[model samples]
Target: MSELRKTPLHDIHQSLGAKMVPFGGWHMPVQYSGILDEHRAVREAAGLFDVSHMGEIDIKGPHALDFVQMVTTNDASRLHAGQAQYSLFCNHNGGIVDDTLAYKISDGHYMLCVNASNTEKDFSWIKRQCTPDFDAEVTNVSSHYAQLAIQGPKAVGILNSLADKDLSSIPHFCFDYANLDGIDAMVSRTGYTGEDGFEIYLSPEKAAQLWQSIMKAGEKDGIKPIGLGARDTLRLEMKYSLYGNDISGETSPLEANLGWVVKFHKSDFIGKEALLGQKETGIKKKLVCLIVDGREIPRPGYEVYLDGRNIGLVTSGTKSPSLGRGVAMAYVENGLDKEGQSLQIMIRNKGVEARVINPPFYKKST
Candidate 1:
């Protein structure tokens, strides 16, 4: 087996007594103090995460915007410089290749933040799509920076202390260059958790220093170093899709309830035809959130049933720390996904009763 990669914060995680595990080919911290503790911290106070394993790809040159627009589902033309939009690259058949965050750095420059597991695939796909006549350069720049996600209700106050400029002014989805703890960084008011937060991208060499600075700055705010365990539960509470689990190459964005990111009126994209057909013909299946009453937590791959007939399978699930109940997301037949619909998840040879509902299962404090 190939050796797993480690992030810049790997040593720090070990020093903190984290439980490390393999994740998407990287040695990642799955928990430190505990998943529940870190989860609660993010909900009530704040938590920090090392997300440097995520991929960063840059597209530049006169046809950058055009090239990006051709590959992604969202309308890139709608984005202003320094603005980012959640988008997806779909195959010709409308199946998602990967969901990405496309950042418009300038008229002819763009950056794509993609899932770690799909990094190579996404980059290769993007490169192959750049026809010989296309005037653009696609660069894989994942190794150049480290990413930190500081998330929670008090996230702003914590980062504001170390930032050279006020972070409050950088609204969600917008990014700007800033000086963080004496290191040049790109600060974006974006997070996977359903909390007000910032995702900081900085030089890999400066990552440890910046991580320590943020930890010290947020000491009084009860900020804790979070791990993948908490990050999964946190994002699950928000119904955010994890690449290999909630969404994948086999799932169409329409089936994943990601139609909002698909713009059909825009010029031809990779999956425009297939998606258009799906829209016109109607999506046969839809993603739905399920709230289970008891402790039998529904888990991924669990079969979902309605009226004693198997309909679909669970994508992601957790015993939510915030809600104190089990929550899950599954793909079921389209008509069975309506809110308040009853369903059952088969766990441990028994069917656990559940109800379909909409999410963000846990909303952030305003």
Candidate 2:
């Protein structure tokens, strides 16, 4: 008996004949057709993602803005209603507690989308941080909503066919509530893949219907049901860091190469002081993207070497479906972290030649 939780679309995933697997305490589809097939679908046309397992927390009231400013790196005061910003919450020691998306719904209401693994921890942390004068009311609404990502080049066209709302006006990181055939939903112009797309949040009960509609609308463009394997690859290609894999408590934002996301200018957020200190001290172990020279695929935990001497380990690696080669991101000694420097990855007791490449391995063709 798998102890993992099931989303409302669990049955739908089964009906679609998806190969289910456990992911972060939830039973999710690892693939529908195949990883490569699904990956190509999203890359060439459109693909649907069942991301309902993600956590959503709502922050409400007059002091909501103030509350966010105290917890997150981005200045929440900069966000207007219906806008979303990518941000981070850090521990005092400059370690990333979690990376999150903050969406301002209205004048005093906001929604924070977080990684599923950190839902409880994030909620508890925010609760403790709410001040006596902070008039915000926080609620964990993860189970109340279901999120579907419609991604690819033709995603907008497919989305346009399914809903009445005009998506053209909805710029990136912006969202609006609209009726998807009388099912109240929030549609946001955002996606993990480096392509034009939308993420739809709606009632769990209506998710299957919406999912079917999206596929039908995108039939001409060749939409396919994607899974976690492809999702990971897509985000990796975009150089987007995964929570536990790329950035975690042990990894600081500066070392993870996400220095841009960490806003030090903000007035006193968690980890601000520590991050500033680390920045001045010089980042020692920094994340670097690498491309293996041969057919040998480098996997995570593979030791990295500079001049045949061990210095780091691969944090995340994959046989890049898009690149037809092995690519990985790893924490390496700063002194040996020069881009284009020749390095080695220990794969199966064998040293494989590799080179430090500027992340992301997949660059959009001009």
| Candidate 1, residue 251: how far the Cα is off, in Å | 0.8
User: Candidate 1 — what's its lDDT?
Assistant: 0.93
Per-residue CA lDDT of model 2 for 225-301, tens digit only, reads 99999999888877789999889999888998888877777778888888888889888898988899999998888
Clashes of 1: 0
What would the per-residue lDDT of candidate 1 be over residues 42-152, giving only the tens digit for each residue? 999999999999999999999998899999999999999989999999999999999999999899999999998889999999999999777999999999989999999
Pairs with backbone N, CA or C atoms under 3 Å apart (clashes), candidate 2: none
Which residue runs does candidate 1 get wrong by more than 4 Å? none
How much does candidate 1 score in TM-score? 0.98
Evaluated at residue 88, the lDDT of candidate 1 is 97
Q: Which ranges in model 2 have alpha carbons more than 4 Å from their true place?
A: none
lDDT of each: 0.93, 0.88
Residue 126 miss distance in model 1 (angstroms): 0.8
